[model samples]
Target: MLLTQADIDGAVGDLSGVMRRTPMIASRTLSERIGCDVWLKCENLQRTGSFKPRGAYLRISRLTPEERVRGVVAASAGNHAQGVAWSATQLGITARVYMPTGAALPKIAATKAYGAEVVLEGTTVDEALVAARRYAEETGAVLIHPFDHLDIVAGQATVGVEILEQLPDVDAIVVPLGGGGLLAGILAAVKPRRPDVTVVGVQAAEAAAWPRSLAQGHPIAVTAMNTIADGIAVARPGDIPFAHVSRFVDAVVTVNEESLSTALLLMLERAKLVVEPAGVAGVAAIMSGAVDLSGRVCVVASGGNIDPLLLSHVSTHGLTAAGRFLTVSATVSDRPGGLIALLELLRDLGTNVVDVVHSRVANGLELDEVAVTVSVETRGPEHQREVCGALSEAGFLRE
Candidate 1:
């Protein structure tokens, strides 16, 4: 069914009490960087740490009493699983969630904590979704799809409506695209009221489907999807969302892995927000100049349910991508003083040493030589270059 403005509004009304009114905060740092008034729609702070409940609750609530009695099942890497679990608990219905075997530990724990029977299966969300479907068929349970239904689209549309209410004068809405539910819902709600408003969808370059699908005039599934943003790693766009996105979205932009890491770091260090990689795709687009928004813009931070271990890795990656971190290897004298001297040199050169490792009896090491590797923190790209040049000049940098 086509998601009309009236349907979206009805969802908004239905969700007023159940869903949190997530904040829309202005970003001064981003505004200065992008040359436009920038605001963040903090859905990462919403219930279940995502915008999923807006749609999940609305869809489940509309179920007939008989359907509710049979229980609900869903497949998600994390966010949507938690949403369905939380919503089901609220409505006094049992929930069973199928998650990928490699899904984040925290998300799996959270989903179970929200009172769902958690089943770990497959290696990807699509695989888990297949399990959900079979369970639904076998047990007569309601399958709560992550995205793809009319009610789901309408429920997510409420986010767009809330954005317009919070920032009526905003000129553009930048949404992170996965299955296109969020982007489609936003376009349905925003474009109807403000036809002039620009609605753009941001997708991860590694696993993006909208660009290819839009070009081909049909939904095409991507194979071997791999990206840090597991939340938005949809292999294909849902039919409902694909139709809405094709008709109403002004533009769709893609951001690479480096930009995504950098944007997540920017939010953590600058905005002090713990946003997931998928949630920062919109910010990544702005930071990387993938999308040029010349007017007031609101970038939706779609989720915050990130694995801490992954965050640790992404933080190092972000630092390296921003030129704030570096690793160097060299051959040094096989003595304790040699390591101390290298550390001193780094300290004198205004670089902070993060870690140091040494190895002897290696292929390239002589009897008196040891392989030394150092990880250091720098200020920026120029600073890193300067440090590397200094090390090279001192004959301590290997290649």
Candidate 2:
């Protein structure tokens, strides 16, 4: 079904009480760095910690009473599962969510916490979706797809309506695309209203389907799919979304793992927001120079349901990418006073110690000599260099 502004408005009306009117915040630091006005659509703060709720609620709300009574089933890796589960709880309906076995722990816990029956089915979303379909058929429940249906597209489009109302002069919009529902809905709504605005779709480099799908003139299942952005790691594009994307979207770009990590860190440290890898793909594209934005740019932070352990790792990865975390190995005498002198030198260089590991047997060091590994936090690359130089000058030879 072709999505229209009327559909977007109707979805917005249907979701008024159920969903939040997520905030649009301006970024001074990003604006200065990009040489243009930058704003963030903070959907990471949305109910269920992702924009998936917008589409999930809209689709589920349209189901008939009989369908709701029969219950609903869905297949998802993370955000979509939580969205459907939360919507089901609100409507007092039963929901069964099928997720991949290796799905994030936080996503699995959150979905179950929302009063849904959770099943760890397969290693891939496609496999889990098959199981969900079988369950839906065996039982008389409605199957709520993540991004393929018209109602889902209509619901996701409501975000575009809010964005245009919040920033009338929005010159560009960068959105993360999975099956194309979010991009389709936004383009269907925004392109008609503002023809001059550039709408850019971003995808994970490891699981990019839109670019290939567009070239093939139809949806093609990707051969290999792997990425940290599990939220947008769709193996195939939806036909409805592909039609809208081919017509309305200005461009589609892919971002690498390093760029994704960098963007995630920037959001956490600079924007003070916790965003998942999929949530930061839009920012990743901009940071990696994949999509150029010369004027007003708005990046959609899509979700924030990242596991704490994964968040911890991504934080360190981001810091390492920014040269804020520095690791240095040195060979020092196994004596206690030798380690004390190195610690003093690090303090004198204004470096904050993060972690330390001492090894002698592992590296085949003599009993009198030990390999001291230190993790330090510095301001930037320059500061990191200063720390290394100070260690060398203190006669602690870095191995």
Candidate 3:
């Protein structure tokens, strides 16, 4: 059933002491950029490093003593796994979390640390979910789905209640859409209190299913779900959350890979916040100008559980997108002084050379020519252009 205000209120009361009331802080940088009074609901700092516990704790808490004795089984990429594990540990219930083989190592470790028996299974969440279902059926364990449940949605809706309480004059709210539990919950809570407030939902462009689902008037599956934002990489929207999204969410948009990376980096550099790629969907949407940045907008910073290796890769990509880093290849004379001369010119132009590879055996190179691929740190787009112009003027042919 679609959640009502009473359900959300009950969830807020139920979640007290169980969940931290995550802060809503003003972001001056985002506010200036978006031309609105921007605020961030910092759910990333919530217990278990995400908002998942809000729903997970509530869902497990509602289970009967007999059901708890049967134990709980769940499949998740990361956040939900930790949530369920932590919640079940507190409730003294056994939780078996099936995670994809490729799931982030940190997430898997954290889940296990929280007292869950973690089973590393298939390559994707959906595939791992199959294994989890089999385990549940065989063991008579209750399957705690990541989303798509009345109680879970009600639990997630408590975030909206907190948001409304924190930012009473909030004109708009932007949320990251995965299975739509968070979005559905927020909508159920806020829409009833203030129906005029605009609620926008964002998804990774590569894995988005909402646009298509809304178009076809039913939940439709995407062909592929490969994305850096693995947290929101659901192939199909959950039927339960879809019902709420259709009724309440104002707009659903997708952010490309580059935009997602840039947003993540921006949050780290400007806000000193380590937001996961999926968690920064609202920021990505606002920064990319995909969402309407009207007055007093609050974007939910959903989670902060990101793999360090992935963060490094995304940071470099974000630097590239922002024109802070550049890679250029050029052909110069094969003489020793040729490479030195190119380096001198770059140094004179204030370009910091990060790495350089010089080779004469590259395909299409002339007998007297060598190919030099240089990766440099630049100030911005203008510095990159200046570096390229200076190289071209020095008779280096860019490749």
Candidate 4:
């Protein structure tokens, strides 16, 4: 049976005090870009740096006394593991988490800090889940299946409840889809009373599974996953959440890897928010024009736990994709004044030089010619074109 409004209310009560009422603030930047009044449901600031704890806390708190005694076991690449660990810690229950060997070190350390014993195994979350299941069976511990149980759905639905309370006239809600717990929960909670509100789900293009699953009327596992949005890079939609998605979600769309990086950059630079690639999927959808939304729109910024190294790399990629950073390779005179002349030209054009690579050792290069690659930062797309035109005009363009 589909979750009722009462189920959502129950979750709200269960989450009282324990859950952080994350902000729902207006965004002028996104509003102008999307041609709608935009609001952000910043679950990135939620405890555990994600919306995972909402469901995790409620699910673990509702455990039977016997189950609580046996503790809980969970498998996750990042967010879910921290959620279960934190929830179990609060309720004085033992928790064991199985994380992929490739899981980020910060996330693994965070899970361990939450008082859960973490076991690293295999290469992906799917493999870690197998280990978690076996451990649960062997130890008789309750397994916390992320996004697959109704109780978890109920918990995630609270996000919808909060949105309506915050933005009663909201016309559309864009959410990130992985196993579909967040989207399903929001749909269940929002659709009952506000059936007019259009709900859309966004996924990383490489890891998307919902579109096929909804089309087939069943959960279909995506065979391959290569995305920086690893938190939402789920291989398959969960059966329970898939039912809700099939019945309720208006549309499921995807954003490419470049779009994900750009969205993260947008959040960092424009919104002053640090969001993970998975969390920013909704924003990426809007930025990529994957979803045509208007009126008052709300996008859930889902999580903020990202590796610093990955953040640095994605930041550079985002800059390049947005045309805010440019690399120009040009062959300049080997004499001392040639490189200086190019630098002066860039300076006069008001571009900030990122770096310069001067090399005289290419196979076809004349002894008097030095090939130099100059990287500079531009304002945007228009500025990028201006910079390129100026270089080509100055006889420094390399093909």
Q: Candidate 1 on 15-134: residue-level lDDT in tens?
A: 988899999999999999989999999999999999999889999999999999999999999999999999999999999999999999999999999999999999989999999999
Candidate 2 regions off by >4 Å? 362-368, 392-399
Runs off by more than 4 Å, candidate 1: none
Any residue pairs clashing in model 1, and if so which? Answer: none
Query: Which digits, one per residue and each the tens of the lDDT, describe model 3 over residues 1-399?
Result: 698777888898999988999999999999998899999999999999999999999999999999999999999999999999999999999999999999999999999999999999998888888999999899999999999898899999988999999999999999999999999999999998899999999999999999999989899988888799999998889999999999888999999999999999999999999999999999999999997768999999999999999999999999999899999888889986999998999899998999999898999989999999999999999999999998998888654
**lDDT scores of the candidates, listed in order:** 0.93, 0.90, 0.93, 0.93
Q: What is the lDDT of residue 146 in candidate 2?
A: 91
lDDT of 2 at 173: 99
Q: Relative to the unseen true structure, what is the Cα RMSD of model 2?
A: 2.0
lDDT of 2 by residue, 1-399 (tens): 688767878998998888888899998878887788999999999999999889998888888998989999999998899999999888889999999999998899999999899999988888899999999999998999998898989888988999999999999999999988889988988998899999999999999988888887889889888788889998999888998999888999999887888899999888999999999999999888898898889999989889888888888988998889999987778887878888888898998988988877756677798888899999999998888887788767654
Give me candidate 4's TM-score against the actual structure.
Answer: 0.98
Q: How far off is residue 323 in model 4, in Å?
A: 1.3
Total clashing pairs in model 2: 0
Residue pairs with backbone atoms closer than 3 Å in model 2 (clashes):
none
Q: List where candidate 4 sits over 4 angstroms from the true fold.
A: none
- Write candidate 4's Cα lDDT for 76-178 as tens digits: 9999999999999999999999998989999999999999999999787888889999999899999999889989999999999999999999999999999
